[model samples]
Target: MADKKPDSPSHEPPRGPILVPVDFSAHSEAALLLASDFADGLGCKLAVLHVVHDPQNMPGYYARMAGKKTLTRMADIAGEMLDEFMAKVQKRHPERHALHKAEVLLVKGIPVTRILQVVEKEKASMVVMGSKGATGLRHLLLGSVAEQVLGLAKLPVTIVKEQPKY
Candidate 1:
């Protein structure tokens, strides 16, 4: 049997799936592409995660848009969006089978906190996310999810910028 790494006692190349958090942005699609490549190269599973976070000003956006008066059904709406997003990903890259069957996970919380929670819960080998980069006042106020994840994640974290040509 092959020996396991000091951090991973499973004797597998990766102890857990590669957790990828997407906000349904162009950069996220790019991150998914690159994460798929990493998963393929490492022979590990992929867990596509979408966190349903409502901004302070727009709470329950999904529930409201879905014609519900409450936030209770937001998870259902988010699931639908995740489904549509995955379908689009499959359509966009018909050749990438890794993206086709990735495990989908959806949760409701703040993006950064939820992301870190997932890494520990899933025991993710790494995290790959996209960054548009926050600038000026936005940087000081909201900061960037990638930067926060990079600073906090104990495991490897890869931040990919959107590459239109890629």
Candidate 2:
């Protein structure tokens, strides 16, 4: 049922996978690790999703060289990054079986919109994501994804900060 994805529309709400949206930041890493524990404790699957967002001013994984610009396939780049990130997370916490068995999903769109959409489409039981805890003018202008998701998401959303390991 974990890999069945959107096809399983009739899936029970409480039995759906725990969705973890990762931005490859330290906070997101923490969220993934924590989500693994949640999944294990609940006996639910973990679905790790990465959104390939490209702003108007600068695209995702864009490189400018000698007045020439090159754009890598955002999906491709995001896929590789997501794979590497999952690997790193699993390596760091080898005991997290849920992390090792997480279902990987890649989608392209605005982070907040895509995330909420994924929640509905995948029928996620809950969302565990990281927040940078942005404040001041930056937060005013570019609100954190967590804040937007919190406001918009219909399901439970857990925002986690980076935890330092001793």
Candidate 3:
């Protein structure tokens, strides 16, 4: 019989950078919490990314107007939401002053593509995100960004699932 050796020690990647995609959901808050420890342990910087997918990207005359209005509203909301979220994070963890230097980004584009772009641009060692596990029609028609990123991202991804109790 072959003897089983002890499992190898798991090692976190060298302290580089962490990219966290936040949609201001509770699930995302959980991910950010996990990301905090990861950043602390790895001694890396954490950057929060918020992507605004243009709802109307069509090229027709009316479509152009629709796209403009939609994009503008989305940009406004994104900016406000990011500000609030950043304030909460700062309040939640004041000790991690280093992490406070994190960047809060708001970009408009396809979620997966934009996420990958930021990851590459930041040279992130890992990505932390939330998963709603959207089901049935929504899942079929509009796939979850987390799932898409999981499939396409080259970096390690940690998905935070929402819990019922909290």
Per residue, candidate 1 scores C-alpha lDDT tens digits across 42-71 of 888899999988757356456545775354
Question: Poorest 10 consecutive residues of model 3 by lDDT?
Answer: 57-66
Candidate 3 residue pairs in clash (backbone atoms < 3 Å): none
How well is each residue in 80-140 modelled by candidate 3, as lDDT tens digits?
Answer: 7778888897798888754587878889888789999999988888999988788999789
Q: Give the worst 10-residue stretch by lDDT in candidate 1.
A: 56-65
* Per-model CA lDDT versus the true structure: 0.86, 0.84, 0.80
Ranking by lDDT: 1, 2, 3
Candidate 2, residue 51: Cα displacement in angstroms equals: 0.4
Report the Cα lDDT for residue 35, model 1: 92
Better candidate number, 1 or 2, judged by lDDT = 1
Candidate 2: RMSD to truth: 7.3
In model 2, state the lDDT of residue 72. 51
Residue 42 of model 2: what lDDT? Answer: 85
Clash counts for all predictions: 0, 0, 0
The local lDDT score (0 to 100) that residue 30 gets in candidate 3 is 75
